[model samples]
Target: MSEAVDPGVAATSEPKEEKPCVQCLVPEIMTAWNSARGACEFVPDEKGREECRKELEEIAKDVKSIKKGSEVIYKAIKSSSNPAAFIQAQIEFAKTHNAANTEAILKWADEMEKAGKEIPEDIAKIVKFYRIQAGSQI
Candidate 1:
């Protein structure tokens, strides 16, 4: 006969690590870029600074994708005064990026709620519209 396993000594599986938020990565990238800005002697020149600034702006735009995601999340939480054009932009992005889905959108909304932010009504309407349109089997 096999002996019973001890409950306290049973091996437990490790929890899956959470993915880093895109927004979270942006600040880190920004910090590194800014540090590069400070350390470069050539950056003292206007042209050099401008070039770095342009690159930084591009990175910021990428970071704005995270902002868009956050906006969608906000839309999910509560109604808003203004349409979340930015968030709508994100839904479009999700479609473009092949990331569109109710689960993903709802997850984004959940994230916003967890962060203590509410989705504005206007933005939610926009997101809802796009989602419905996307589902049509035309």
Candidate 2:
């Protein structure tokens, strides 16, 4: 022997085995696809099973890169200021939507009353408003 080589510095003569993908290690997806396939005696809905299998295969190929890029974007949003302003805007949005929804309920109740159906509570509330407007007792 000429000299002993450092194992860390040396190129390995043996071939390294590639690690299985994280996506493949997820049991739920694999089980869902396996059980969904009828021809394999796993379950029924073989076509659906095949689709899930294809989807998982595609995801496995890109998941590591996809996850890394998404985490960057997510972290940026999570650390943002004015998060409360965003939340307030969302609340006001729900209020505006509720106003429109109430208006539609009133209109629908009017139509239904014209068609001879009894007014429900929400519709009755609108009718009560009109009665107060007309100075008439229910």
Local distance difference test scores for all models: 0.49, 0.48
Write one digit per residue (lDDT tens) for candidate 2, span 1-138.
677788777555787787656675556444332232211222134553354345435544554443343333233223324334323433554556556766676577668878998877865987677656557675
TM-score result, candidate 1: 0.26
lDDT of 1 at 38: 33
Model 1 CA deviation exceeding 4 Å by range: 1-18, 22-27, 39-44, 64-138
In the range 2-87, model 1's lDDT, one tens digit per residue, is: 77778886555687777677767666555544443332223334654455445444544555444433332342222212224323
**Please, what is the TM-score per model?**
0.26, 0.32
Each prediction's total of clashing residue pairs, residues at least 3 apart in sequence or on different chains, is: 7, 0
Query: Which candidate's lDDT is highest?
Result: 1
